[model samples]
Target: MIRRVLACSVALVAVCSLGGCGTLPGFGDDTTEVTVWLMRNSASDDFVQRFKHGFEQEHKDVELDVRIQEWTGIGEKIDQALKDGDAPDVIEVGNTQVPRYAASGGLLDMTLESLRDWGSDAWLPGLAQPGNVDGMQYGIPWYAANRVVIYNKDLFAAAGITKPPKDRAEWLADTAKLNSGQNQGIYLAGQDWYTLAGFVWDEGGELAQEGTGDWKGALDSPAALRGMAFYKQLQALGNGPRNADEETPPQAGIFAGGKVAQMIAVPGAAKAIQKANPRLADKLGYFPIPGPTEAKPGAVFTGGSDLIIPRRTAHRAAAVRVVAALTGEKWQTDLAATMNYVPNKSTLAHAVEGQAGTAAMARGAAQGRATPNSPQWAAVEADNPIKPYMTSVLNGADPKRAAKAASDRITTLLFP
Candidate 1:
């Protein structure tokens, strides 16, 4: 259910005027309502306002009913609603969650011809691939987030480091200097799969690969084993809790506490850190997590929302139009400028490159990879098998054993 209104955030936030059933101008009782449910943080008021106004102009016979929904319990809520045939016309799903819904036949099949309106070619492959299932498109690329190294400049200077690490080896070299009394090196949020995926991709390894219409876990490969080793070494280099899960953002408070040297996170983390400890605001810095090579950063995994339409929607055509207008080139540009997020359209990503977060993220995204696109991937995430496995490895388990067990668990989940 739609609950709570987040007060004005950005300066250009549009004021939404409440419209009663019969109060809407030019819309009458015959007007069909297209209810759209979106998480409060997914879109800005100004962008939604423009979409509402613009869509109305295009479809005079349809009334757009926009509701702000909370992310908490959203998965259960959407699942229940969709199963009960009471789902909204259009909803935004996390990129990773698209598989679960699409594979379950909950979303409408948006064929390639129907998707050109949204500039399909402009989409970042990592952001768009999750929206695809069995060659059919069920979602469109929405705004995305990639990791960028957010560090404390004061800590770096105190540690005698004059420049950020150009590569992972350099980063590891600086850890000794940073990990002194009361201070630690990079604050590796142990539960963050996206950050871990970067190391795997950097080492030319993959978590899973599709074969014979099924995804097989490939973490046991030589390259992946190296990646796993590097990932485990990360925890030992830091002082943060090694047993944390995705449910807990371990870096938030720790970074604010003013001892951790660096952390890999979305651009919004800087805001969160400042909120936790305002005094550290000016001392913060941002950059991409350098890869093994000096020319590029590690391959960061993309995290963002994707727009999907329910199969049972009474207005599929209207929903498509609405999404196209909402994610229009102009609005997307505004989304990046105002929200500090990477636009779904890579073409527009350049516009936001000047922003430190987007710049660092863009550098990483050029080499980034999306999570394996499969329905079972969602189940794997919910189970969080890797977090525990990582914890075990950090506690002294062999990388090969942990990887093999993880692969077994994944295959069991996917097959069962």
Candidate 2:
């Protein structure tokens, strides 16, 4: 899932316009129509149909008009809707996008509902934290996805590894053993910054920090340097390019070639790998990215969607009902099962327990975190310095010097 939205710094005020009404098909004069905008590929047609059918069945007087949206230019389109009032009653935004929209004053503050009705306490922190802007809840988490270590079972067996490593030490040692004779141990790209973020988080280092309304890059912090050191060490076991990301060479294709033993990616990447090479379908395996200790998994950057209501929606109450219905256990279970996503709440992790890949992703989702809540964070990603920093350090640049340059760039983008 694409979690970053284009930077929208200006605040927006809603202008009234006609909301969803009788023009929609099957709309009756007495019926209330609630329009919803859901991102393309976010949910399957079956899941959407089930939700529409069940929601409308429960609220017979209400009509649910769900529109699928493409990701391209969605941020601008949403900004226009929020400002000009053609706004859908409910909109599904990326989990990290809440801060930008909420800052524009066009989203309803759902803190009360989140606390009283929704199980806010049990929601994944990665999704929930970004939704809370200045202590007010504006986004409702829908589902989550994160990266995990996807390994080749056949290669592991051949390498004499009986089970996946339990911690970083065992992981490093095992990876070293597997990094022999044309087999890249992990095939981790130098610019896989999300994976790097996990290592940084595991070392108790942050990419950036907020203090008294100002943000500063912390990539040069002592803990962060240690994280980079670890990344450099592990990256040496792979032959992945130092200048490119996983997608640049399409890591899935490399893994499908049957030489690489492991790769860090979403569980769904396995499907692509299988499509590319069917013979290895049953040879795949999954495990949470091991952390510093046995009981803890490495932290991961969570990517997913969150449902939010436009402040200008005429069907505020109905929109709330729609969100509640979708995030509820029955629909959540169906969505997770149908789409293979981690459920919104930690307690509902069982929704994907039957699938090994998704179950491993769920385990890591517990320690998931979001990028900086600052709306300017998108600007940082737009001209991401972290990627080059990783590449430079891997290419023998001084860690402190390379980190300082990257940190300086990040500060320029993120510092208010």
Candidate 3:
């Protein structure tokens, strides 16, 4: 296991200091080289170059070597690097991956630094809470992206819907009006659990609850069942596959076919729709998923990246500085503007004021929530029972029994 390899390097963490470490081959003795591994497409090359120039101007003694890595098989790559004691000083990982790495004791504890310099209190709860594993902050939130209702403007107009829904009731009403012969109101797949997670959270239900030392699935709870009931009611409005997810045949391609009126996706999906069928380039619009009431937007799963410093990095201080710069207000604002991402902190929403899609995403992210903060959560996802449970419910199975069965599987995986 990766933990075994990471555990062996715990002793080197204390001695890995910037000034005390040996220099890299290309850098002079006076320079501290900080290597960063960012996921592909997270930032544009131009934006990275701009950051490098600006950061290097401020810290002349440090050289930033930023490398973009592909997402496929990244977990194993990261594990291997940690095992070899050759991990990058800073790495960008999914927010959900924090617990697994932090639990392995291969991450630098940044609780003090987060509180002292990064203003930990104001960060978005969805992005912030997952990083705070066992009361210690390991992942520093970089940027966030969540699902929104990407709709066809022409379809809404044709249906006489003057505006987007302000609440779940209105959304259902609007979708029903838009769903007619040969047209789908919304292409919401039955097993799209990330979207389902929002409804569960809206009803104040958790997918899994943390107990004394383990997690127990809570999908069988009354509130969660109510959320599932609502999902069933909405899924019947359109012709989404009950046994598949948004990506089975690529929902973006389906939406681009011009018969679907709406879909729940990140704003980035609009680009794909446009790419598939260029006619939708100017016909699309975005809005946050409406909540049960108009008081707030629906809760969404905040999917985004976080920056981490490996425990065995030679340039620990330089890595910390690099993380600070990336998560700082200046770069955060630039990143949001350039990439249309929600800033790490809710206070930075103003950065994307004029961008409609990102603005809607930011609003939903205000009430966003992450998955269960357990090291075994990743394993649960790998062999996910929730998808089949959703399908079973949609296919006429008893909700309570299906939920109970899925919950049992979850408990076993979470505590395995």
Candidate 4:
């Protein structure tokens, strides 16, 4: 009986070993261990865990090492990692920062062949544009988010507005009626790049033109001057708050608190807004941004994380697999529903249910353009001399002089 029991135990061990149940691939043999560096946000953590578990279950021979870093420290950490020779195999980077890293040779060169093999083109067109520097791909879009106009239906009804605006004129008129001593019609972040960029684009003016790498001050143009004037008009008429900072909670807080009728906000903000005021969960209505003319509908700026492979990685093949699984249809769809973000891939639409508003927002994102992908983009935005100068124009400064001053400053930054 003892001999029979021992034999049965040995048989069970052999079965388990054959299935590769206990060992990760490339552990003892030539198996690969890939390290993934991800942001330390709550949503990102959940995504990383789900992706790691799923990939590990399928590819039992592979080992995944995940390192989470706070968003504030990511840039410094990545720079330090590269110098220390401890760079991760794969990295998750913000869309805006992707260009800076790629331009500095901090990422692997992903060619069309690599993208095709990995099947990354399933995402939206401009969604993955950030990972490309000088037309060579360096990253895959993991997920995407964009801004939209969220309005209170009850407020609109109370203000006697028949419907949401389709053009700039109607938008202004509606805001005028919605404006009350207790409630502003719109909640605009004063220095919000996303909000400013929408107005800039609507006026047929670009912050910077593509390819030539020239910076002409479009902010001083007649069209841009007109747009800025309109913006100040709203502020003067009490349609929006004064002295609201773009990066703080109060901008979104007031809107969520039912003190404002309409506001420009990100898709990811929906969950937070609903959390702030539970009653707002079903009362929110979404609409595409209105522009000066139907021919030029205002464009929503795209914002999201990109999946990049580091040049120093030893597990290139495995890293590619990880990116594929993360950006796959199943993951994209699941993430969109739970996080209120749009999926990177167009095919993942079916994964999201009851999200027609998000779908419309996605279409707007596709039509949008990214800010100049130059390495100097950060410096320009940080040292934006244009804002104060534009403020002068809004307060009755000469339009041409304001445009020229802004243009000159931008040109110096771009060319210098």
Candidate 5:
């Protein structure tokens, strides 16, 4: 009986050892899982699904949990998660929101060594700017998108314009010519903040400037005033959308129907327009936003989502691996082709060449600039007073007076 019992004990021990029943948990343990939080954007959803499936398939022992959060309530959700100690291991955050989250210690400082180890340095400088706060890296560039002047070639020809405008004056003249009965010359989406920012940067002015350990408002400068005045002049030219609220559908519908001449738009709209009217795909033309001065064409704002590691994650290594996979060349190449975004890496630009409207956007990304990296930037921008002030300026409000009021309001917000 003693000998039989010893043999049974030995067999049990072997079984347990092979099954990992008595080992201290280490990296890649069977029970280890990574949770990723992301925005519910069209691009992110596609990337996450593919990435999760591929990574989990390759690593059978590991599991991935994805949580999609609405963008409107993401900030509050992140804050709540962090407070409750239930934050995701990896997160997809807006490029502009990086500074705010980093400042609040909501994100982990991903070192340069990690980027080098993952071979992510090949991405363009502008794409990586969002992840760098105060010279420290905390996020990775997943993908990027930029605004460009999309025009209907048919409308241009009808207006007797042989070529797209190469400078601001030409754009103005062209818009005036396109402004005919019920067929507006241009479609300026005044209520869209992103579009307004493009115009602001084109005039060689910025919303904020680097100050002593923070950012100060600069929207009231002469250059910005001039830019606003130009937008107002254009708004007066025809029956364009009154604000950005009504601008997108009407402009897109009109352009696809061959009524409007040109407008500023993102790359995603290209595919939508093509789907709406297949013939317009071939008729569409893209150009960089023209600057006020001949020497410096206007710059468009860089807006896109980025990958981050929340500080509260339990599976750091797994989360890092997930981020690496999502931002890797293979995934980025595929994403750029499907989503019409500029690949984060310049080398990946070639993957999206044959796609409509992407080549011009890639060119624009190579030459675009980012908004000021400040935690308070969103607040200052969202102030109700500023938009109306801009609307007033766009409606032929005095440049100096409108600028003064905007400057004063921004100054109070920043300084206070």
Candidate 6:
């Protein structure tokens, strides 16, 4: 049996900071021990144990030892572990973080056929692309989600709008109807990079374009500036807190008051709305933000996790098997339902297709995209020039000029 290791938050951080302390969850007497590290909350203990036991059943001599890690300082911690020759057999990496490891050759390079054997064409849209660096598979997607929009049903009824907006004009028109001056409509976070990217992608814009040798910032492109202009246009329709960005996800708090007609939402938002204002919780409805074409959902920046084998693991074959089993069809189906994530394997997302909320999730997942390919993306995100540049455009600076400045900064980050 695998043991559970629990530590206080402070202790956990300290232990991780000085490189990992291995054998936390368990060290079975079995000769073959396969250790796995999972990001906290990425998967529930119950399901993980199931996979652990399943792997053991398949390989009688091997024992699976599971350890939990926090997102904070994880990259540095993992790197420390590798430096100290204490890396785990398999590690779960955030999708966006895959490039850093893959480009640095910190992960094993599995052949394309080997990856297909694990989860092939049935994989969710854009989930597998991040793992394919230079056309070699270094990681496999585990799960995914599309950030979406949630609106007040009561406000929709009051406006005589029977359905959610199907296109940009309809979206703006509905917001106009909901804005009675005492409260705002269409609560958009000014500095939120994900939603900002969504608007850009909705109009066929890109945050950065991946080049042969390095990534180039595309914010100055006509399509991207048009999207930025559209984002500015939305700010004009509704008023909320200014200077907000990913520093805090401020839209949920603003829209939970029930007076706001609509706002962008994410997973766990329903529970948050209930906590913020229980009465209006039941009135909330969800939909994918529609694209320029009414028939398709707007482009969402799909976020997800990936499973990879560290280059140093001795039991490469065993670790690969565990990754394959964990991402198998049966496990994928149950996990998607439990976590309310669009399954990394989209064919398995059927678990939630019957409901209005999850159906919208399914639709959005179809139109979703991962971030552009750039190992140095961490630098861009760290510098975070895009949000402030967006704020400048919203604050009346010329959109093209603002975009050019942001693009220049992004180019430096992506190259430097």
Query: Best by lDDT, which number?
Result: 3
Better of 1 and 6 by TM-score: 6
lDDT tens digits by residue: candidate 4, 1-416:
99999998798778767764333433345456788877766255676677778888898767888887788868777777766766888888887777777765767787764467656666665566666778888878777777777888889888888677887788888888888879888877554556676677667766665556644556766666666666666555443433344456455566788878887776556677788899988878877777776654576677778888877777777887787777777777767777667788766755543785686576566556567676667677777866666556555778678777877787677664
For each of the candidates, the C-alpha root-mean-square deviation to the true structure, in angstroms, is 9.5, 9.4, 7.7, 6.7, 4.5, 8.5
Query: CA lDDT of 124 in candidate 5?
Result: 57
Each prediction's Cα lDDT score?
0.78, 0.92, 0.93, 0.71, 0.73, 0.79
- Work out the TM-score per prediction: 0.85, 0.93, 0.92, 0.82, 0.83, 0.88
Supply candidate 6's per-residue lDDT for 16. 56
lDDT, candidate 6, 45-93, per-residue tens: 8888877777788887677899999999999887777666679999998
Window of ten residues with lowest summed lDDT in model 5: 21-30
Candidate 1 residue-wise lDDT, 195-294, digit = tens = 7777888888888888898787877778888887787677677876778853366577788999998887787888888999999989988888888889
Top model number, TM-score: 2
Runs of candidate 3 exceeding 4 Å displacement: 1-29
Roughly what TM-score does model 6 have, to 2 decimal places? 0.88
For each candidate, how many residue pairs have backbone atoms clashing (under 3 Å)?
A: 0, 0, 0, 4, 5, 0
lDDT head-to-head 3 vs 6, winner: 3
Specify the poorest-scoring 10-residue window by lDDT in model 2. Answer: 7-16
> TM-score of model 4 relative to the true fold?
0.82
Error of 6 at 155 (Å): 0.9
